[model samples]
Target: MFTTNPFDDDKLREECGIFGVSRAETASAIVALGLHALQHRGQEAAGITSWDGHDFHTHRAMGHVAGNFDRDEVIRGLPGDTACGHVRYSTTGETSLRNVQPLYAELNSGGFAIAHNGNISNAMKLRRELIRRGSIFQSTSDTEVIIHLVATSSYRTLLDKFIDALKQIEGAYSLIVMTPEGMIACRDPLGIRPLVMGKLGDATIFASETVAFDVVGADYVRTVEPGELVIVTNEGDIRSHRPFGETHARPCIFEHVYFSRPDSIIDNSSVYSVRKAIGAQLAIENPVDADYVIPVPDSGVPAAIGYAQQSGIPFELGIIRSHYIGRTFIQPGDKVRHLGVKLKHNANRALIEGKRIVLIDDSIVRGTTSLKIVQMMRESGAAEVHMRIASPPTKHSCFYGVDTPERTKLLAHKLDIGGMQDFIHADSLAFISIDGLYKALGETKRADIRPQYCDACFTGDYPTTLTDQDDVVVQNQLELLAERVV
Candidate 1:
């Protein structure tokens, strides 16, 4: 039996989702709803920690939010006026209940609960140093390193220590921390990860996406600015601080392409609109003669519409995806596994047969899915298959929050456009240029000096130092050498 999760391997996995609320009557319940809205970001584990003034209550489970937090008893177990929750897909830690977020630690000051949304690039180095200093760790998660840093900080106040811990960390983060004093929310200095603040009457809300606020009847306030911290007290007093000083914002461009929901807005731009713009740009760059423009389904829908509109090609649902299936299905044997893409998606044979089709998609990662998808279309008798990608080729692996395979595994990193076209068995393949991608974002072109967004996966201009990955490479090499010697 094939027990592996097939649906997740082809796409760039999202980092995590975080939701928190202060001064709500049923804060844990509200958090559960909010996490449900942001569930696409993660599916491995879910956790919530709430403060009932006198004590902190926590419940964490190694599964989806609906399975773990949908029950009344689960929500009732976490009674408090303030609560924070996390839905995690691990990038820097093993997938285990112990690695789940809303990671609570009782400090000398009081109980501290934290939920994180991004990767700490220097976490391994920090973990090694902290371990050498005799700091006992409860979890192998990189998010735990932040708590250790806060615990060892020389700062007097809890807030100061939290900020002190953040200052020492590198890479992306959108953190929601609940304390005995209040609830705190902050984003990284570069704004690489997204966090938004909102309000529901007297309740103050913080979530990874605006869609979460929409789910709980909360009005969107504003995005938590890069390097800015906002604290909401038990009495509903709000305070904002800028601790990281000034820095250029480089929000992840991939969020618009795949991670964020189409309904959500980030930095005053509609994600749906941005994706449409990307598709329009792709159409302008790579026009092709086709009978119909078809999306890969779901993620590619918006872009496919845009491409069709721009190219004067009729858009049709040439492929249908099954919604009832979970992310994975246990294949009974090789025969079932060979069914491949048909398990999740099937070509509308009547619509696709004898038609020259233009297929639109957000991004192609490892290319395994693309290969299978193309084969599916061919098997269904597509006369011609022209593949158009809305974003530039993803050549480098992401070291920030987004979970991507290594360079060796990336299709773009190993193959040029011609090579990819042959590999996927498509009649033609074209990806939007990097400059065209910036144009879709309303820029004339990408800035050569400092990019307006983190397109590192496309451009290889990483914004932060990748210290952990460097150490990992060295360790792997040493292990290989030792094996050879033995």
Candidate 2:
């Protein structure tokens, strides 16, 4: 079931986004444009694989799609009616060239290309079993593990092999595969990641978000049902199949809260409108007497507007984001990553000087970014910074797809509200109540089909238990870190 809590504060992390096209013309260019719309989900790497029913051509690079496939020669190089693309953000494996997806494998039957959005919780077990059968791995990613399993399967047909492979694996996965025959898209039985279909005249496209379909002037059809597989052929035939019976349809609610664009819709709900309602609910639940309601730029913009409208407080863009700030410069180093947020955002001193500020932010994952923002606001002469989070406190880690680690890595799990106020240097800290959050999104009923959210990170309600010793080791490491901090 989906976990809905207002006080559950956690920074929502995005996994990845996918786009695939099946048309006779320049499918590579169409995929490039579709990937551009879905780029908000990932930034680490971009890749596209095209097949012309005869041969497969692939292009991959470690940057935004614009720079990675910037040249016409690169796009023109891959000619095929059917193409699959991926924009990746590493939540599990090390961020490197080898990890860039659209992981392709060649077998005696033919070559198949695959791009996946979510993670498998039991990947270690699956990889171990495959290795026992003598399968060599080029990348440390769990996604590659799936391809290997399917390739070595006894099933003669690719679709049968795919079904057989999924039966052995457990956890969240929204996959798109390219075969010699056609294009295949499948979502996990739980549907933790978002995948939707669209139609533009005579063409059919599948993407991680509805925004991608909108870019190509395609009309939204519907979300790929949980435990369902969709196939699109070269002749423009679309087929849907549900092999798995009634399982939990636990779509990631965080997608509506943070990962997806406000303009996009997921699971038949408008993400932007739902987020605005969350802010409105926050204002009503925790009304603050402040001069102005300021948002933490970008992510907080929509919610801030709703909060201001609900509380009768003036809305102001107190923080401005600089688009020119390249995402690549924020390396893994502590000092470098810490300064990245500062370079990306700056406080509007002229508007905030000596004002009582009610700062709205989506979530505080590590608290580093929020701490920096609050300190910057104080330096800009803000009298007091009251932090209001739009979602609940994240107390656990998400193993499904998101990069959230063990409970020890979560600030809310380690510190109380008061301690968090001190750590962030905010005069006050109040998060939206979980009930109120669900009410705003109209997901108050626990038994509703689409109401169950993947609150594993916020509530520790992990859907699947980890059995691998290595997973336990990672969890223990986080526990040790938390103990030392306490």
Candidate 3:
């Protein structure tokens, strides 16, 4: 007997998703729908917290949103006019319900609830300092550090305290906070993570993606600007502030590449169109002679279409995916594991056999999946398998919010282009140039002085300070010195 595991992939994972609404009669229910739409961002756990004027209510569970928030009883129990929700895939904390978001606390001001999407790069250092100052933490999540910071701030107003807390933190964050006073939403200074504002009737909405707004039947408003904060009062008065001051905004480029849904818009560009552009650019940069262009399915479909159109080659669905399998499943044994790509994907033998094919994929991380996929093509009687990747090689790990392997483990870091081609057993392999990637984004080329987006995984040009990682390096050096002394 064989079983499939969907988590066996070579791609990066997003940190989390956040959705919030203010002054709505069915706030919790609306938030549930929004979170459901954004579920692809996180699948480990889901939570929602709402304020019903006088009291706060919460419901959290470990699993998909449909398993927990889909029940009518669950929604009815959480009665509130203002609500915020989170779906989490842990990046900086353990996989436990205690680390789930929509974390709540009662301060001198009133009840407070918050949901966050992004990693705090300096959380470990901040956690150490806060513990030294007698702060007690309820969860191991980095988001909890923000709660403690707000609780101890001397600022009289809740908004000021929240701003004060944000000032002390570093790295990416898009926060949706709910208090008895109202709902507050803000994006980090560099906009490393995404947050958008929308409107449903008189109700104000905030979510990690525009797709969530569509799910709730809300009118799409603009993205919450970098370093900008908006507070929706209990009485429904909206106020905007720029507490963090202006800086060069370098939003994560991966959102367009993989993180966001095709329908959603980020930084005023359509994600679907941007992906197609990337494929077109890839075709121009790495033109290949093949009988047909075949997408890997799902994520690769749009790019493959663009590649075919640009290269004047026929596009075909040469691979099919099984949607029935869940994100993860327990493998029965090694026999099943060796089945490899067949568990989730199967080659269209009639279409692939005796054909020279150009296989298009969004990106390659470890090359394990690519190797298996190429081997499957050969088994299906394909004459030649040319792998065409839409993005530049991923040589560095992401430190902001994406879950990526270390540099030593990255396939690109370990192998050059020729080595990768041999490792994957592909007839030939090519990736989009870094400058070509920028061209797809409407720029002539990437600016060496100040690149428009954060391509840290591709270019290794991190936009923010990496304080915690530096501290770790220093600590490891001291430990090694002590061992030598002994």
Candidate 2, TM-score vs. the true structure? Answer: 0.92
| Candidate 2 residue-wise lDDT at 73 | 97
Predicted model with the maximum TM-score: 3
Point out where model 2 deviates above 4 Å: 1-12, 330-340, 445-451, 469-486
Candidate 1 Cα errors over 4 Å, as ranges: 1-4, 474-486
**Local distance difference test, each candidate:** 0.92, 0.83, 0.91
TM per candidate? 0.97, 0.92, 0.97
10 residues in a row with least lDDT, candidate 1: 1-10
Residue 35 local lDDT, model 3: 95
As a TM-score, model 1 comes out at 0.97
User: Which sequence of candidate numbers ranks them by lDDT, best first?
Assistant: 1, 3, 2
* Cα error, candidate 3, residue 65 (Å): 0.8
Q: Could you give candidate 1's per-residue lDDT for residues 38-119 as a string of tens digits?
A: 9999987889999999999999987778878989999999999899999988888888889999999999899999999999
Which 10 successive residues of model 2 have the least lDDT summed? 1-10
lDDT of 2: 0.83
Local accuracy of candidate 3 as per-residue lDDT tens digits, 66-159: 9799899999999988899999888888888898889999999988899999999999999999999999998899999999999999998888
